[model samples]
Target: MFKLLLRRFFSLTLPLALICAAGFGLDWSALALADQAPPGAQIFELHCAGCHIHGGNIVRRNKTLKLKALQRNGMDNLTAISEIVLNGKGNMSAYQDRLTEAEIQSVAAYVLEQAEQGWK
Candidate 1:
């Protein structure tokens, strides 16, 4: 009877452990970890700075966006900014495929936390 119970326990535990491992693997794959810098700053440098200008650099002939303008424009929160980065707007191109949801959220958080505070 004890042997049968032990076998049953192993049977259940083995699959459960495998499932958990698989879930973790899937999560790791889903999370984007490409940015070596802050996510928001990286996103801006890669996507926005090209045309909007940033950090005292003028790469294009467009108007620059300061922190205040970014917050007032609804990028004050991570969720809103994430959607914008993922979907893109106006003349901006979408980064949905280029960045994962995690990357978007991280970048959005960084922008809101560091940039918005200075805007006020």
Candidate 2:
């Protein structure tokens, strides 16, 4: 009976400790990488990469980050992008709760900058 209890304790506690450590480690890595780039780029990667890979929207054929497309949609500026990000339009979900105001600003700034650079 003593051996059984010891085995059970180790089996549960060991995995639990490992899982906690991994979660903390991942968070630390995210913070470190976030500092390496312009704040917006990092935030964009975390939130937008799934759909807007390389500034090309997979979900929308016409709504891309290319200069001409953005200009056509009136999304070539920070304010426009911020509004879309905050309120979400069409298929995109709103990030108002998921990201802070500063983060949304950063992403908006980043998108415009990247667009000017032609997404290089």
How many residue pairs collide in each prediction? 2, 0
In the predicted model 1, the residue pairs found to clash are: 39-107, 40-107
In model 2, what lDDT does residue 10 have? 100
Instruction: Give per-model TM-scores.
Output: 0.50, 0.71
| Model 2 Cα RMSD, 1 decimal | 6.2
lDDT top scorer = 2
Name model 2 segments beyond 4 Å from true.
1-35
TM-score (C-alpha) between model 2 and the true structure: 0.71
- Model 1 stretches astray by more than 4 angstroms: 1-36, 55-65, 117-120
The local lDDT score (0 to 100) that residue 100 gets in candidate 2 is: 95
Q: Tell me the whole-model lDDT of each prediction, alpha carbons only.
A: 0.66, 0.91
Worst 10 residues of 1 by lDDT: 55-64
**Residue by residue across 1-120, what tens digits does model 1's lDDT show?**
999999999999999997998986765543455445665777766766666443222542332245666655655567876787789777556889999888778767765665645523
Best by TM-score: 2
